[model samples]
Target: MTQNIRVVVVGGGYAGVMAANRLTQRDDVAVTLINPRPDFVHRIRLHQLVGGTGDAVVGYRDILADRVALVVDTASRIDTTGRTVALANGAAVGYDYLIYAVGSGSADPSVPGAAEYAHTMASLEEAQRLRSVLDTTPTTAMVTVVGAGATGIEVAAELAAEGRAVTLVCGKVLHPYLHPRTRRRFAKRLAKLGVSIIDGPDARVTGVSRDAVRLADGRELPSTVTIWTAGFSVPDLAARSGLTTDAAGRLLTDETLTSIDDDRIVAAGDSAAPSNLPLRMSCQAANPLGAHAADTVLARITGGQPTTIAIGFFGQCVSLGHGAATVQLASKNDIAKAFAVGGFLGAKIKRDSFPGLIEHLAHEAHQPGSYTWKFRDDTRRQRLQTLAER
Candidate 1:
């Protein structure tokens, strides 16, 4: 009898779950998925969680493959030489192949007192806590949302729509990923919703107090609550295990999604930096990366060559409160395009797709190789290659 291949996937985020589900296609492989939480966090809807409009989570049973063994535990370290992962619960899981899909979280900002006083919507717990804070806050309480990225914009809009006095402190520019015309429309919507937009060189947050926020330009904003959505930082498990990683601590992989240091180790999602050219950290990329990682493992097992990574880009969708959004069009390489869909149409896209994301995952679980996306653009591919060479 052939020995069964043991594939251990760490982190139960979108990428890890997709990889686990896809790996179940083969009978000869035993896939074990490790996650700290019992439920899957719909990170894209975390702003809704903060706004009290959504829960931002789905049970693993709803999306994960029934055949994939679930291990609820936290990974402390990866012993690559020993091919074992040490768990926080004092157990270790040995694997013939490892998939690193540990996703990202709220970055530790340099601003003083922000870590202690500010709220971040990086995880389900954080979102829940923010919700609780919002529950107690007066409708007219001054709430400052730092950063004008997707999370900040969404949270500010949602809260402002609920009658909270919301201020959006844009670090440098508002919706930098958006075209100027779409940005103008988005800004108008926010203003119409009673959200104050602070943009300029001095818009950067410098400090957070118990009830206030200070900007670089000596502007002190009276804030009863502060929400930080500035940047993201990944877990340090890869770096702690001494694996080769980028400056941000994401595991370095080749085009095939296998770790450069160890062929036995594969990487996907926000935790993976392939060829030093990682796609944007979004579900748009994570699902594909996860599917590709599983394909690579299966290819190796069947003595087949794995395909090189080729990911195309789609545009960004930003929810401006509940009934409005901005869908910025993009080229295959994710460059901003002039065309955009806004208002009710954009809101419909956001609302319709939020629930469909899980359904899409469930479909992948049932069909294994059912997930697919846009092919990579040649120009972008060549440009990335040039960057890698340099």
Candidate 2:
């Protein structure tokens, strides 16, 4: 009888859960998923949760494969040389293969007192906490959202629509990913919904206080609620494990999604920086990368060839205040085109995309032997060659 291959997946997010579900389908593999939380936090819905519009929690048992063992614990350390993972509870797990999907955290502003005074909408807990604060606050309470990225824009727009005094402070122009026309349309929509757009010369947030936010120009805006949605930084787990990482501490992986220094270790989601095609931290990359990582592992175990993970750029979607939105069509490089939609039509598309993504992930998880995509050594070699030439 063939020995059972032990595969351990850390983090129960989209990438980890999808990889665990895929790996468990193989009878020869025993999969163990480790996470600190029992339920998976749908991070994309965090903005909605903050706006008190939706529930951000989903039970993992409802989604994960029955064959996969769920271990509720934080992965404290990874001993790659010994093929063991130490948990926070003083238990160590041995694995023939390991998948690190430890995702990222909110990029806190470097400004003084912002860390203490500002609330971020990065996680479910933070969103819920922000909601609680909003519920008790007066309707005329001033709220300032720092950053104008997707998360910042969405939260600010949603809160503004609820009749709060909201101001969006963007270090740069709003909707930088959208075309100029689309950006102008969104700016008008936000203004119409009572959201003040502070950008360019008046954009930078210098400090946060209990009752106001200080700007770089020595101006202070009265704010009872302050939200920070600046950006994302990868978790320290990759660097802590002594794995090769990028400047931001994301694990550097080969084309096959395997760690460059250790073939037995693989990385996916926000924490992974692929050699040839590094992508931004989004569900678009995490879901596909998870599937690809599982396929790479199966190829190695099944004596099949590994396949190159392909990343294609999908268009951008942004929720305008209330029942309005903007969608921008983009090329493979994420360059925006003149094609754009706004108002109710764009909002429908934006709302529909969330469920559509979940359905696609569910469908991919149900496919049989989906883990065994052929690997291309030539692709890896060419990527290395390109890097050398650069």
Candidate 3:
């Protein structure tokens, strides 16, 4: 006799999937997930995809809840007033509540010739394109990886491990999120693997050509294939749809993850900027943000008020090929600590994190509330909540 509540979640990444799975806690709620790709992209292993060592996709059926309907289509626009989403396939999906989790993609580089010549590997399609290009080029081609973040380091190491002539064109210092001690350890490991790293005050990329990359120091490196992994850029769906957004284009939300314009609309994952203070854009934060987004919607539906959002931060893990990794230790506040772990243990933890991500979604799919209980860090949450208030 009760009316079914309809909830729509966009983007099937970690946050979207987790939110969809947890919404299954109520039989009266009908959940729908909209994603452009049929297969869920295991983002952490995207470097492996480019290196041809592993697949970066997993079937949605493997992790999504049975109760959630999967719609494979690109969302062109969101009609908040109508509570409907327009799809590229000329279809529309209606929702009583909407969760915006359309994660992020490689940033559009501004350096002259970089956009025209450089390649990026932020999505499955981009990775596959780079792989195809790699296949055609000579083995000795000078491969330049621009950027020193986790993606850049992983890509550079993966190629070097495969015996490719690889150069890491760090814009500045390497692994800026890591401590100086850990950065040194990573540099040594990379050097041992034969990766040419160019990093200094004037190491920023200035331009890119068909066969060379120019640096600010007036040096030009012969680069047959230039890959850009500098930063992430979110989709402008919210802005295109006339919704309020931060300077970075993320949907601006309050502590409850609800949009400033509409309580019926909430955001999570990389595209969510909460209280102008979003957690780092990573799968680690996405999983918990997803779960909490669902909780807010459920609370509103049942006449319970949604509380503040609090997510913990675990430092970064950069897999240096199959041989090693740098699991940077960090405080709950997400600062990298001096102590680090790697070699075999870091490799083990990084390997497990791949399936570990899927396991969280599967657990919530089979048993709705288990994710929040098993993975929630209460002490860290309290700390983050206090930070939000201030």
Candidate closest to the true structure, highest lDDT: 3
TM-score of each: 0.97, 0.92, 0.96
TM-score of 3: 0.96
What candidate 3 gets wrong by more than 4 Å, as runs, is 1-3, 373-390
Q: Rank the candidates by TM-score, best first.
A: 1, 3, 2
lDDT by residue (190-269, candidate 2, tens digit) is: 88889999998767888999989998888899999999999888778878889899888888988788999999998888
* C-alpha root-mean-square deviation, candidate 1: 1.3
Top model number, TM-score: 1
lDDT of 1 by residue, 21-135 (tens): 9998888789999999888999999988888877788999999988898999999999999999999999999999999999999988889999999998898888898899889
Over 53-168, each residue of candidate 3 has an lDDT whose tens digit, in order, gives 99998999999989899999999999998999999999999999999999999999999998999999999999999999998988788999999999999999999998899999
What residue pairs are clashing in model 2?
305-375, 306-374, 306-375, 306-376, 307-374, 307-375
The collision pairs in model 3 are none
Query: Which model is ahead, 2 or 3, in terms of TM-score?
Result: 3
